[model samples]
Target: MEMTDLRLVVATGALAAVAAAGAVAVWRRRPRPGVPLRAGAVLLAELLLVTAVALVVNRAEGFYPTWAALAQDGTTAHRPPATPGRLDATIRRLAADPDLPIAVPWRPPSLAASPGGGATVAVPAGYLRHPSWRYPAVLVLSSPADGWTDARMLTAARQDAPTAVVVAVRAAPDLDPGVLATGMPLDLQRDLRVTGHRWGLVASDHVRRSARDVAGRDPGRFPAPVIAAGPGPSGLATGLRAVAGQLPAPLAAPAPVLAPSAAAHQVGRHRPPAHGPVSGIGLRHGP
Candidate 1:
């Protein structure tokens, strides 16, 4: 049974009750019970009761939501480390800032059993301060060739689309947009606080060239496609030909999404070529 199941809690409680009844019977059977017999009965009852209480607590509070988490020894389990597992490491840093945005590379497990290209999640600042606040989110689609780092995608979202969460998608040029449109967003919503019903899309010209037909066909998922016209251009062009009518908030009506643009910045020390060049990604739109 899953750890959170109510049935498990009920079953454990019932077993504890049975154990207590058995202990009482053993104690009352003889006016003078031997120390060993009484002790053994009492111990069994205590064990069952303690186990029941633990189950109840675990049910109420998700200490170990899954068995995998409970068994996960925070050691060198030799699992693939989270991509870009370290700091953004910009050249402009004089002092460390604790309030920097959080980024976590996520592989939707549903993709193999469910197909999905890996994506990096960029959580905005103040996400923790307001538990009830849910932010709009966007997916910035670019290939490895574009050199779009997770950090760059996050920066674009913060500066241009300040009101929305952003996910830098590392996807193949030919991969089905359906894989992203249906499953990817759902998986993201399941894990993060962002609204997943619909998402705004940011596509590089290279990616749009190949997947535009498929992506444009699904306005329900990708309501607005903001084109990133190469790295040198300072402005972003809106792709509305495929997206019929004005889209919803974070896309068109409520707050039209500004094309994400970025200023050139320096990286202190990037990963070696063996790990892939850390430089070059996104439309290098001028300040």
Candidate 2:
């Protein structure tokens, strides 16, 4: 949720409390005959007042992106910044390529089964070109909104001890909200399912297929036996959490890292070689 929205909620709650107290005070002093009705009337009025307050609050905070227009003026002009990463750059290039292969040689390599019986797709740095498996892979779900750009993504892979791979499912175009509401948590799995149905596949059935496609298309890009996985804001833990239901084993929870560890060293170990360079991933777009 946006900080502004949170403040509004808090303010509305406070107003509701104050209004309720006032209603009770008014009830205590009312004459006896229609006391019950008087109390009910006051309570109803309070409720209406609270609702009005909440609507005004919503209008001010602009929490609902689709319906609320009051705050749209402030947000419409902003564009998210982009970062470069090898994978992000590759994905962006792939998205932009008019002549991209209708059928890229995609295959599903067997992934390490999560304890929950679902498979995890990992995209390590330079899975396309890097030789050393010395970069940490990030497990992303949907694409990063801002900081997790292609360049930034690649930079993360290059800079980290173990390169990162984004973990995400493709979604239907209709599912793209353009701008998500401030407080609504994204459910990529459901969105992907809806998106898959649009593509003429069963939603649940296609997740595995998508994962397989990711694995088959890029082998050895994701290092098997993951050292540590970090979830980015949208993609990380949430994506893993969604996939857990389908994983073969329980996925290990990520640990907080103040700094890179031995595994981080392992992921970045190959940068000294000619094929390896300690830099962020390349990108194809200016955005």
lDDT values for all models = 0.50, 0.30
lDDT of 1 at 15: 85
- Which pairs of residues collide in candidate 1? 110-114, 111-114, 111-115, 147-281, 231-284
Provide TM-scores for the models: 0.45, 0.28
TM-score of 1: 0.45
Top TM-score model: 1
231 in model 2: Cα distance from truth in Å? 26
Once model 2 is optimally superposed onto the true structure by TM-score, how far is the C-alpha of residue 255 displaced, in angstroms? 17
How would you encode candidate 2's per-residue C-alpha lDDT over 1-287 as one tens digit per residue? Answer: 23223344566667777777766766676464376766775776678677657655543433342333334587552211121122333333454342221111111111112122221223442343432222222233232232233443333333331223333223232232222212111111111101100010111222333333323222232222121134443333333333222211101222221111222333332223334343333321211
lDDT per residue as tens, model 1, 1-287 = 44434567788889889988988988888576898988898898899899888876654433443344357676722122212212223211321333455666666642333224467776555444334434566776666677676666656555555445567675675565545543444455545555433456767666775345434434544655677766522322222211212222221111111111100011112112333321222223222
Best by lDDT: 1
